[model samples]
Target: MPFYHKLGKIPQKRHTQFKQPDGSLYHEELFSTIGFDSILSNAYHINPPAKIDSIEKVIVDASPVEWDAGLRPYHFKTKGLKFELDFITGRKPVLFNSDVIMSVCRPESQMDYFYRNATCDELIFVHEGEGMLESNFGFLDFRKGDYIVIPRSITFRLVHKTAPRLLVFESAGPIKTPKRYRNEFGQLLEHSPYCERDIRAPERLFTSSDKGDFIVKVKKENKIYSVHYDFHPFDVIGYDGFYFPWIFNIDDFMPITGKIHMPPPIHQTFEAPGFVVCSFVSRLLDYHPLAVPVPYSHSNVDSDEVLYYADGNFFSRKGIDYASISLHPGGLTHGPHPGTTEAALGKLETVETAVMMDTFKPLKLTNFARELNDENYYLSWKD
Candidate 1:
């Protein structure tokens, strides 16, 4: 999570009457997590946030299309995914489990209405595009290589300046920076890969006091509900707290190197209940004279590994380009593809950029994912 942020007009004390220009009190709403025990924000709105005009349930069967369970690894080529013009409609779920859902979307256009995922926190990796994420908290500008994190139940919309391609991760639990990187006071430590300066919060406010029919598409329990509000969803005039949407660029993540190769935990960026998100940025290899820079083949005992190739040359694998995903499920032995270890023996650096997710639960592949499967990927290691 990002640090405390505030925008627009707010009262000196929360829960107090903050009057508007016409002597009317601004509606005070407390947005929090974990039933107010966790991080929270206090926002003053122009209208009551609970005023709803109507609600319609839109059933979307998001259940994954799974294949036979196996011990083999899989590779999906999602570089050519076909997405519709709308943002929500274009999302194609490729892998999912009880803990998390991983999907890809290449939206041809912008979202028409607002959205609030009541069930999960959204971690959207901007693979290819520029856009502004407008929410009740404020406006957050995002570009390629950025991980835009939106806390659960925050109404927002993505306004893309160009055709946007995104890799989305929905966490059943709140997504936060690795606790080890933060101090007891919740501030990032000096040794952390990224600092507060690298984290970008919503800088500008986008408050709307307009009264009209506004649609907010809410996702709850694997179903989308069209909720119509009597007032604009962005009616928030001001808000302040530790809970808000923020962005962290993958390029800003400084990889930690050592005499010998480091473990995957060193690359962890975000963590949830049953999963962790990692950023594999371009960095120097191990400095040990005889060290093998490429990772050694090992068995993942209780976690499944998913890697999404964003950009740069991935020297460890073949036939993987931008937007390619490789899944190494639990109980399988995987590592640098054949010959990668030998090739990296004398290498000083690698220019590979990728996003990786390690989940405790096994992920099921969707039928749409099967369409883009590289059936021969499992045999790529054969001589």
Candidate 2:
């Protein structure tokens, strides 16, 4: 988040004694990043936030095994993915590297225990579902097309109202609004595609005073550990900060347009250390009389491109459909399909929606991705 937000009750000043009804001082916990040098929040809790009952056990290995997928353009059909119970275990990694891991999750069951990803920030795209994201910061209602950005170490759980189909990204560093979209003071600029008003932070706090064994499945270094806390994780009475979970819907993005076909950066939605996420939504096409209204063939020598088709017609693609993921590695030149460029001539607009991730480092495929791979996708450009 680029702006400041405060929810629930807070004291007049920082580090001040905020007494509860029983006269005991409210516990103040500082949620910070980059060793207190970066964004942080002051959270006042009903009980001490670090009351550990016991280290129960190691739950499961959450690491994705890399499969040898030789460098070439590939397409994955994810519509056939099987549903799994719970949100954490349901994630099936498709592509990953040191900086980011991309996965598709079809969770049939809701989460029973709270989850805290200790090592990576999460960017979850709700492809198909409506749910409430309950976190220590507060509770946020998320629906389809919403990108829920959860920072690392946030104790949270997904309460599903319907079966969720999600595209999840685990980033090694903080996921942030593109720097170009913000000013020096961290406020979104007027020309930005989306502003603070379009971003939804947790408005309702879920303060709990219950005491007992509360299970929190924590993920750190690709391992899941079940930790038992003496008090409920959502014990925060108030919090004020920029470091919290937020929701940004794809529909709210106003597409940037030009007389000539614009590049991928114009569609950028979020940025991380090694990758940038772009959203392709319904928008007007290039107005140039000679414009093709589609992307031209280009070999991006610096990054790999992955596009997850969410909805609508993808004019540049032929075989891709909803829930299809196309990977174009750095070495290959990919563009509009064989006849797509010629077909797109004289088009006034595009009613397509997709999510694209361009990673600076090369991504490796997982076994699940290999199973869903369309072996002949690279040959689609052949006349």
Candidate 3:
């Protein structure tokens, strides 16, 4: 395969030196920014001015999308779980044609995220399942949280192989870590503030046996090509680098607060470029004299906002299910369904739950997403 840069037994790479008491640089080739899923886009990217020297402003357009076809997808089925892929654009859904897309993987065991492909960095939200990911970097234990930038080129597998996991994959654009978290110099600031240690990089990369039929799918020219390797991709015994899986737990998020709370900032994590992720964890209502925990209604004149209901009550509207998402496009108004807003205020406290992701770029609704969707979402809140 052309995308297959088979490094043979030894991939061309130098080990990082934090260099050991005994001077030795091993061929630690495993953690090389797994970009196995790198892709060219049909959308336009624009960087707005960064007001805070640390924060960056990026604007994206649907132009990068191959609207003529839409997105592509990957599907898998393990034991306990079923993986379904719904793509917005990649290829015109003409069976087996795609690139730049999304995939949902449902696994049976507490599968070690224990493999890597120098492709497909993931902006993963654990829609279900709990536990940790053991990597060469460290151990990241999380349940139902949004994990962004599990880089493509690195090797990793989920640990505590028990329950199944619901994973979403966006294959077209790179799931970049935020750039503001690092200086132009690449060092995390005491204030840029999340550090490298905060991210769970693998402490030691493990090499796998190349004796099996490893059917790795490689995407090129928007088409997926299957390459059979004599061994598994996780053949590296030990490796290290800036490339690895780092986790930001939703609960660990240090939210910005004031006498009056501020709205969510787009630049929440990154510790990378072109990517910013935030976790909407379970939180107590604000202590303001008068705080409307429920969102107010207004047409978005600026950017498109998307919210994924990961877990919890989502502020009073009952009967909520997992993996529910709401997309309020620009030039449209949305608010607390209807009666919920007024009823919400009467209650002294709320145990609402949700995970929201707002994309500055407008996202078109996929036919599948539109189908599986709770069509009643928009009208459910009505009195």
Candidate 4:
């Protein structure tokens, strides 16, 4: 996050003594990034954050994914994924590279233990169900169409009332709002697609002073390691910083309509070192009298484009329903289906809502990805 946010109570001055009722000092810890040179927050805890009671390393076979056909376009229908009881275990990695890993998770149960990603930022898109994301910073109430952006090393858990389907993107780089959207002072400019007001940060802080062993699963270097803490992980009495988790709903993003269809960059929501995330929300069609409403055919050239269809009718494709993922690899040419362009000409608007991820490097598909793949997708464009 670029802007400053604070929750709970803090001392008037940082690094100063803040005593509890028992005359003991509140433990202060700095959560920082990039060797303490980047965004950071100071959190005051009731107990030392380093007080660990036990440790266990969980071996996960997250081996590198491989493409079955060795680099070609693909269409995967992820609606067939089984419902898993554990949130983390439910995630099935579909496409991945050195920069990002894309997975789908359908959790039938709420998370029992807190979780932290030590090396990567997590962008979880809520496709179904509503939930509350609770963290040390505070609590964020999330609903369907919400994109929960959690920075690395933030201990958090999701509690949902209904079965949740999530599209999870784990990025090795920092996921931030588009740089061009903010000015030198980090304030969102007027022309940005979405403004700062649309960003939902932690609005309330709820601290727990429980004295019991709590397990936190920490993910680092493709492995999940567990540590037991003597005090509750959400014991933060106060915190103020630029780095924290936040939420942005797809429905809140104002689309940029045009006389002529605009490029995909116009829909960008977040940018990182190797990939960019864009939201395709329901918006009016192009107003140009002679415009081809559907996207024009073009070679991907330098990027691998992946689109996850979440809701509504997609104008440029045939037979794809909700939760369909289409991958157009670099060097391949792709566009609207056989008759979609002609059918889109007289349309005034499209109710489609989808998520797109464009990566600089090609992605590899996991073996599990083959289960829902449509082998005939390559021929769908033929008349």
Global lDDT of each candidate: 0.88, 0.93, 0.43, 0.90
Which candidate wins on TM-score?
2
- Cα TM-score per model: 0.97, 0.98, 0.64, 0.97
RMSD, every candidate, angstroms: 1.3, 1.0, 12.2, 1.2
- Which segments of model 4 are wrong by more than 4 Å? none
How many clashes (backbone N, Cα, C below 3 Å) per candidate?
Answer: 0, 0, 56, 0
User: Candidate 3 on 1-383: residue-level lDDT in tens?
Assistant: 00111212232334233222254332232322224443211100011111112211332222223223232211111122243321111111211112223334555443311344333455565666676564333445656653645555333456534343444544444454455555666566565434555554333334444454544443333334444455445544333233445555555554444344346563265312222345555455556777666657766666555555555677634445465445566666666655676676634444434454444454554444533444445555456
Model 2 earns a TM-score of 0.98
Tens-place lDDT per residue, model 4, 1-383, is 88999988899999999998899999999998999899999999999998889997555655446756766678999887789876777788999999999999998877878999888899999999888999999999999999999999999998887778999999999999999999998888998999889999999887999988799988888888888997899999999999889999999999998998888998999998899999999999898899878899988799999999999999798878789999999987999988889888978899988999999998889887887799888888778
Candidate 4: what lDDT? 0.90
In candidate 2, what are the lDDT values of residues 1-383, reduced to their tens digit? Answer: 77889999999999988999999999999998999999999999998777788886546888899899798899999988888877888899999999999999999887879999999999999999899999999999999999999999999999899878999999999999999999999888998999999999998998999988899999999999999998999999999988899999999999999999899999999999999999999999999899879999999999999999999999889899789999999988888888888888999999988999999999999999989999998898888
- Superior by TM-score: candidate 1 or candidate 3: 1
Off by over 4 Å in 3: 1-104, 109-119, 130-148, 155-160, 171-177, 187-197, 209-212, 270-276, 316-319, 346-353
Query: What is candidate 4's TM-score against the reference?
Result: 0.97
Note the residue pairs that clash in candidate 4. Answer: none
Between candidates 1 and 2, the lDDT winner: 2
